[model samples]
Target chain A: EAGVAQSPRYKIIEKRQSVAFWCNPISGHATLYWYQQILGQGPKLLIQFQNNGVVDDSQLPKDRFSAERLKGVDSTLKIQPAKLEDSAVYLCASTLRSGRVYNEQFFGPGTRLTVL
Target chain B: AQSVTQLDSQVPVFEEAPVELRCNYSSSVSVYLFWYVQYPNQGLQLLLKYLSGSTLVESINGFEAEFNKSQTSFHLRKPSVHISDTAEYFCAVSTANAGGTSYGKLTFGQGTILTVHP
Candidate 1:
């Protein structure tokens, strides 16, 4: 089976510029997530969606970051006015379950965003 | 809330030698623990997981981890290392909320880089 897919494996942008990342989850997957991984650090959860509705986004920076999964199959994460601190790899993951279960998540290659 | 801690930032060991990577977590309620391996320019893949029952879990690639509820630790181990096993290993934890809303969100550690020398 095919795993999660992401676009623009690498990206570069100037500070204060806007950038967007795309994610297409595994087939039949019901849950999708977005994470940020800084160099030398593990990925941190940014937002989560169950189908077309958001499940959690408490850790996301509301002022600069936003994400949406309109049709529940694909999702997009956007960062406006990017800062140097936002330079990191953005990973997308998906799972088959929407409720409590021991489901494993499948991750994508990630989009490495470098803000100069 | 949950958090994970990886004691070692990097570990170097010769091939065919036994190795251990330490991990500790903090959470008030019960949690599901997992270990993920990330190769160069690749996404993280699940190595193993510990949910309930057995404290020990093994991955298909000869990696194993033991979950210790008393100490709140889950350490990954291998009887003998291989060069191909060199990668960044991450420990993560997630708790199921009382509302049965398991968003499957994970809290990951800083990660440990394992370098295997032939």
Candidate 2:
């Protein structure tokens, strides 16, 4: 079975520029997630979508970041006026359900964003 | 709120040697613990997890972890690691919020880089 898929494995942008990353989850997966992993740190959940509806986004920076999963199969995360602090790898993952090991998630090759 | 801490930032060992990666966690409610491994330029993969059963959990690759409730720790250990075992390891905690949506939000620790040399 194919794993989660992401686009533009690497990206580079200026501090004030805008950037967007894309993710296509595993087939038949019902849950999708976006995470940000800064260098020297673990990945932090940025948002979660359960079949096109947001399940959680409390940690997301609304002022600068936005994400959407219109069809519930693929997702896109965007950051406007990117800051140096936003330089990190953005990972996407998928699971059949929420909050259970039986629904273990499979992650994608993250898109590394470098904001200069 | 749930948080995880990995005590070691980096551990270097020769192949066929024993190694342990220590993890500590704090949470307001009951939680599930997990260990994840990531190879270079790759995504995170689950190694093992502790939910409600036995305190000891073992992965298919001969790696094991014991969940210690009193110490609030879940440490990963391998008696004899191979060179292929070199990777970054993460400890994570997840909890179901009492009032909010029932999704399990995972909090991960600063990863530990384990390097096994031949």
lDDT of 1 at B45: 95
Best-fitting candidate, measured by TM-score? 1
lDDT of 1 by residue, A8-108 (tens): 99999999999999999999998999999999898999999999999899999999999999998999999998999999999999998734674888999
Candidate 2 stretches greater than 4 Å from native: A98-102, B97-102
TM-score of each: 0.96, 0.94
Candidate 2 chain A weakest lDDT stretch, 10 residues: A96-105
Every candidate's chain B TM-score: 0.93, 0.92
Docking class of 2: medium
Candidate 2 local lDDT, A6-43, one digit each (tens) = 98999999999999999999999988989999999999
Estimate, for each residue in B23-117, the C-alpha lDDT of model 1 and write its tens digit.
Answer: 99995466889999998777899999987789999999899999998999999999999999999999999887655444489999999999999
Best by lDDT: 1
